[model samples]
Target: MPASDPVTSRPPLPAAIIAGTVALIESAGPLEDQSELVRAHGAQATRSAQFMERAWLLGERLGLPDDLSRWRSTIHLVVAALAVLVALSALGMSRAVVGESRSINAIAALVTLLGLHFLTLGLWLLSVLWPGAMSGLSLGRLALWLGARMPGERSPHALTVVRATNRLLQERRLLPWAFGLISHTIWALAFVLILAVLAFGFSFHSYQLSWETTILSSEFFQRFVQIAGWLPSLIGFPVPDPVAVQHAGAQGLTALTGADVQRDWAWWLMGCVFTYGLLPRVGFALLSYLRWSAGVANMGQPDSGDPYVRGIFARLEALDPPLVTDEERRSTHPAHTLPPRGPGIPGTLAVIGFELPPELPWPLQSLPVGIEGTTVLELRLAGAAAERQNAIQALGQIRPWTLLLVCHGASSPDRGTARFLRETSHRVEKSRILLVEAEESNRLSNSASGLRRWSDWLKAEKLDAIELVAFPEVGQENA
Candidate 1:
């Protein structure tokens, strides 16, 4: 049997995006790890495949009971309901446009129907040229607002997902095509409903269709009808003859119009809506949807030199076993501690701080061994990825020496700290020790909840080779 195609096996686009987002949220390591996976696999494959991989990973992580798939289902229902709502709204507008008059103004209705759409399209184009200035006219915002208020099961989550996905893609400068897809779709649906209601109005109601213009003439109207009805006439829609056009223009329906002439005018009006209004909207909607799909398939390939793109590449680089960076050496022995000699000191020592408290003095004095010449490097646990990477690289360069990671015992261990330790372990072969320090007034024992939590994390990472030391009241003693 032949193997199934990866694209065919993957879920739909909505499902893939939602699943990938959930994977980012539930990832074991830092949120960056999921992005790293996207960059790594995406380098070798299409973005669609990378998206599929993320969905697969989410299923693997969350198992059979995951609710990510519910987001896609909810979105489909919401979109269907929106289409219906748009149709209903358009029906009301169509009735108001073709109102309760004994004689319908054919020129007014025709111009109003086509003119409004043209005006909207022009404004949409202008807004694209000058974004934010006309953001109030944005269809994406309208869509989001409607989605949030949609009433249905799980619709809230689906709408939230849509808003989040749109914002994220917008930050990456990829939302225009996607938003266009949605706008054109709504427009098409509205146009279709308006046309349907107009068709029904003409069929059931008996009314005279005439053109009344005090500024125009019979000759001018004859020429206008000839030009405007050219396309509709070609498609078999009945066009009024020059005599009937002159009669409608001169009499303004004061004389009784013939049934055949009225039928001809009705067909012409329906044809105008079909050709000029509905057809163009349908075409634009299809084009925009195609553009959005193309964007989704190629989302991994962002333009060069973009900061976010560069950041993704940096993540991919860090995924490799060996990475290089700059070096630095700094130390401050502001105050030295009376030596409490411990057996765990290596031949050469390096002290690295991870978000150490500002109150902790420089060249930490609590080390059981004397550090007369050892290099000391301080890094905040909450620092940028580049800073952490640089610290790891600097430590790797000075190896054959054991490394001590000093942290404040009062702060709880978090995933960020765990990720830093894991990444650092991959870079160097020396003994990696963890030193937790707090004022000696605090208890230091394995039974202490804070210390036990750190112990559990270390065991989970399988980095138990190094010692875990807690400095109790050492700060008070030194003072």
Candidate 2:
């Protein structure tokens, strides 16, 4: 997509850039310009309209960020997990005296781990952790040392600050949800592995109560009680215990029944793996379902449910109708992700690195079109660590007269976000660099946030003589 240029646009001039700075403030609503306190505004902006004043006050009281749009999904995910935890605890009614406390502790430990992950996100956002540390956890400690030892370049950290931060493949902004999902999945899988090892490690599982009764007078044979406690958390089986379950093996109350030890153990393995394995993912699925429902309910109405949600729900239902064997169960890519959708932006251009579904509107589909002497290229910098690095290297190679970097369409403020444009700006010294900070990516990635930072970096690098211009919506029009 090409357009006629209004001027001899090799690279915009500093005077023109400085003149259009106000448009940044206008497009962004209000610019607090708090580099010191860079926080990603989350769901705060999406509070129910009826409670706007009180909600704003509460957000301020809690010192939370102003954009609460994500609160619905985040809260729904947590609440969904809590609901499952509650249900499982209620069903795993322990006859043992200390059973309740022990189970509660187990749940608490899991919850505490999740909470720590959340705190990690907040701390990273607050810049308490050294730069680029949290998201690039895959880097481990050595990366931290490298980042720290590397001298800080124009980024606020004292040159010494580089001594502590790490070299993340991508920026911290990319790491949060991606690594979060990875960590959570790893933990869930680890839990399943632990349960499998424990269950199989035991030798004589046929041990029954020998026709005895518990303090609650529950006549649960060992088999029944074991299944009872394990079933809900494992597969949502409403029945309490596995005692009544039969297949083939040892006999008598204390001895194995018709259930063969190996065969029964295999079932236990599959069941445990399925329950612990699938629950977190399923819970996330449910959380999305709930959030969508909540969104629809709040936003007037929906003609019907999303087919994606219904498909997942259908998959869940299929589990019981037709027995899926172990091999099929263990296979990866068990379910499909929802179709692509992007955040909203108006009167702005957006181009995702990847093929962002052809359904997107015009300017958004093909952006950076009007630059006079430069070709706008989009890079889908996804995948392994090496891939991201390669994308950056390729970016450095472009040698354009202007380079525009935008992602996700989220015009939100974030940390060290300016570094992207700063580095790109330097690479294309002959070209001007504009960081696209639209509503979707409007937060910290704001071009305005980096403008001063870039100027400062330029001065620090003794490159203050370079001409840089910012093209706001108005500026773009005038140009």
Error of 2 at 129 (Å): 27
Give per-residue lDDT, candidate 1, residue 41: 50
**How does model 1 fare in lDDT?**
0.59
**lDDT by residue (tens digit), candidate 1, 80-130:** 776787677677678876678758777777886677677766766665566
lDDT of each: 0.59, 0.34
Considering every candidate listed, which one attains the maximal TM-score? 1
| Worst window of 10 by summed lDDT in candidate 1 | 333-342
In candidate 2, what are the lDDT values of residues 1-479, reduced to their tens digit? Answer: 11222112212121111112222222445222221111111111211111122222223322222112232234345445644663344223221212322111222222332343345435433432344454344422333343333432232322212221111112222233333343344445444444444344333332221222225333333454365346644444332234433312113232543435433443443354355444654454444345434432332111126443243234333322233578656645334211122221222221214222233222433333343432444554333445544554555444444444433322232323333333333344343433434443322233554666665654654345444444345455578
The true-versus-predicted C-alpha distance at residue 280 of model 1, in Å, is 0.5
Per-candidate TM vs. native?
0.53, 0.25
Say which candidate scores most in lDDT.
Answer: 1
lDDT of model 1, residue 128: 56
User: Model 1, which residues run further than 4 Å from truth?
Assistant: 1-85, 97-100, 125-136, 145-176, 254-257, 302-304, 307-411, 414-417, 420-479
Candidate 2 structure lDDT:
0.34
